[model samples]
Target: MTTPLTPHITTPITADLLRGALDLEQTAHGVLPHRLPARARAQCADGQLAMAESQPSGVRLVFRTRATAVELETLPTKRVYVGAPPRPDGVYDLLVDGRPAGSATVTGGSTLTVDMTTGTAEHRPGPPGTLRFTGLSAGVKDIEIWLPHNETTELVALRTDAPVGPVPDRGRKVWLHHGSSISQGSDAASPTTTWPALAASLAGVELINLGLGGGALLDPFTARALRDTPADLISLKIGINLVNTDLMRLRAFTPAVHGFLDTLREGHPTTPILVVSPILCPIHEDTPGPSAPDFSDLSDPGDPSDLSAGRLRFRAAGDPAERATGKLTLNVIRDELARLVEQRSADDPNLRHLDGRELYGEADFAELPLPDRLHPDAAAHRRIGERFAALAFTAGGAFAPEAA
Candidate 1:
């Protein structure tokens, strides 16, 4: 969509016009947003967290504009896996007056290709791409350009046919959510389609999603990040990352959970906090995790001769018997989390626990199985989001209007 460049205005993209990011740092080309502050990022030695935090899962450029045309210059980091099929282009979703208006994806940007066998990555830099949207609805309205959830993007410039300004406060409560890849929208169609984003829209709340892909390992820096961030509602989806990474044994996990909660409570003594357990993942239900990729056969058709189409899958690699020696499994994690919440709820009345299975369980699994054997697909994402809104933001829910 081409808009006349003459008489167009350019708006310098800044932190105040952004939402869902913890901090922003000016870069040589533009501004690089961070989901974790500098202090928390400084504590990280892991490369996965570094990549995840910079992805900006829930970040967006929000403003009020009457412009019928808008263009944004961005340099997005796209990921590629060696020996695997190409991934889809990252999507940028636009909303006008709180409804989806359009979507765009640029063809050219920087690429980071990873060789899984060698555990090595190669970066190929490219020029910035313009994400342009035209024919927007008329009248001054709140506009949101939701960033790609899985790609790291550096904002360069914002141009519009008409002037745009910071959106006025809407007085809606802000919800801060932290979790793993599934929460980071691994297979969801777009950024706004992520479960947390969907649920936030359903409940009419602002969102700050810290859903770090492969990085939600109960790090103290993460807890501290949550502690310092302002929020009216908070939720932590635990277990999947810990179980998959096989990070800690039961004894250590118990204290770590308590310590993480303690740190959050220091900053938000009475905030409504909801701790969620892992959802129904059959592979990790009884078996200890330490999950590994299975490139064997995802299209598991039982036919004798048709075996040409197969994709990457995942499976639990740890010994199930290890649970006797204090290893963690999804089922055990759920039980432990429930018990801990019950015990702690006696003193912290505002704290609550939600069984993740309630969001996606056996029956749903039978209907919509996880295509990758781990992360739920886009359809499942919608179901989980709807269930979350019903359970967490409705009448008897923690963040309900009446509850507040």
Candidate 2:
């Protein structure tokens, strides 16, 4: 008499398990997580927003299972800049019972090659890849599979050695955060390791990260989205995106911020709203932008390897004199944000402002320079996340339990 074979369980991926994404679109192969809802996406035809939303920087697959082994099949759309340095493979982090258990990386996926000089991009199809993790602890355990923060992933399938079910909510406060690419996990090691993710874990809060890369231009729709989304705490990291993109002048900036806050207050009348200015970016600290790629020291174009080795840097192209004409820089934006929050807090006691410099100032910058002079690297992400948690989530802090 032979023993019966143990059966594996396959659960269909659904929205309930997802936390940070605003929308989920079912594809023929599987599902794609989007940070912006269909309505929001429809409002803006900007390619940057489209790309940023599709990346799902803070999105993860969460569940509870007794399984000892798990596997996820995905088709990630990896981006490649034609003349820029090669990016590392996207990492999928697995957490068991709130702790990191294992990690894996997909080997193959579609490639999106972009020419920054020409502003043109092309997509090339590639094969799907699988991530497998085994040797989990016994008994029921909470599990989270964090998607790559940089790559746009399409989930294909999930398999477990045992049945999986939704984890019961621990009644954690939901923190809704909005910001630019640094907050979008650029140069971050993994999804769960992103600054927002790290802060959320430390604060024991569920996160709804709206950290759109290059898309955090203080758009009315984004503020509207924040207003509609439910959250116990909210934070906005503004300034860098505006400066780097040279999106607006001080004349237009102040009113736009007020309008954005007004829209958010309409829905969250009493919620704690923290306004964080951009962290230290020396390149744009005083220099006005539209930041431009600096390929100045790069070797001659014939060799792709040399081209790849040539580190890409960004320079502020806007003149310092432009400030007299109402042009905005990081320093100017920070000052404005501080003053705005202070003025608003007189009547709106829930408003608070934290100097972004306190999080990553000159001292920290000297120790851990930004890799691209724009986005923070993995180690810096940790430093910023830890600092944010200590400053904003601890006692007497903006998001402290008593404050909330």
Q: How accurate is candidate 2 locally (lDDT)?
A: 0.89
Candidate 2, residue 359: Cα displacement in angstroms equals 0.5
Predictions: Cα RMSD each? 2.6, 2.6
For residue 256, model 1's alpha carbon misses the true position, in angstroms, by 0.5
lDDT of 1 at 361: 99
Candidate 1 global lDDT: 0.90
Candidate 1 ranges beyond 4 A from true positions: 1-7, 296-310
By lDDT, the best candidate is 1
| lDDT (CA) per prediction | 0.90, 0.89
Q: What C-alpha root-mean-square deviation, in Å, does candidate 1 show against the real structure?
A: 2.6
